[model samples]
Target: MPHKYHESQVRRTDAVEPSEEEKQTQEKPAQKEQSEEEKQMREKRRERTERGREVGAEEADAGEKT
Candidate 1:
């Protein structure tokens, strides 16, 4: 069999290398700094989420008592 293209013409993904910034981002853990407003929003959302779970738990406990 004869190949139409040469070796250099073929694209190889493995040859691609990550840059220094990319490598650093991967190596170092990301630290997200949220603003005061963002922090308050996140806290409120978290409390709202846990509130549902708490309600469910209370209902389950009440059912067990019946």
Candidate 2:
């Protein structure tokens, strides 16, 4: 009598090749440049805040009656 198999078996050497899109995603550097741009944006925002404060103080004094 022949023996019966109870479970499915997978080969150890089988490997699925990465798709083209996956390869491109792995090679992309957009995130690194995005963070640098974000840092620059924050610096600009701080500069704007400082300028606004100076303008606001000048406006406040100009509006007061001496």
Candidate 3:
């Protein structure tokens, strides 16, 4: 005896378009603004993080020497 299998089929359909209001909301959002002081603080935090990494690496190398 031989086994029998059923075949599957798919139907094509047109895509639904978005309404005017939906299109507007889907558009790009407004840019955000940051204050000068906030920007400066952010940069300072980044510099401190990098400096900390360098110091840690130096300490590790020194420890290995002892």
The best candidate in terms of TM-score: 2
Model 1: per-residue lDDT, tens digit, 1-66?
999777766544434777688787776544333356678899987875676587886775575579
Q: Which regions in candidate 3 have their CA more than 4 angstroms from the true location?
A: 1-34, 57-66
Estimated TM-score per prediction?
A: 0.33, 0.41, 0.34
Q: Rank all candidate structures by their lDDT, best first, as comma-separated numbers.
A: 2, 1, 3
**39-60 per-residue lDDT for model 3 (tens digits):** 8899987776676687886775
lDDT: worst 10-residue window of model 3: 6-15
lDDT (Cα atoms) of all candidates against the true structure: 0.67, 0.67, 0.59
Between candidates 1 and 3, the TM-score winner? 3
The TM-score obtained by model 3 is 0.34
For candidate 2, lDDT tens digit of each residue in 28-55? 7887788899999999878766766878
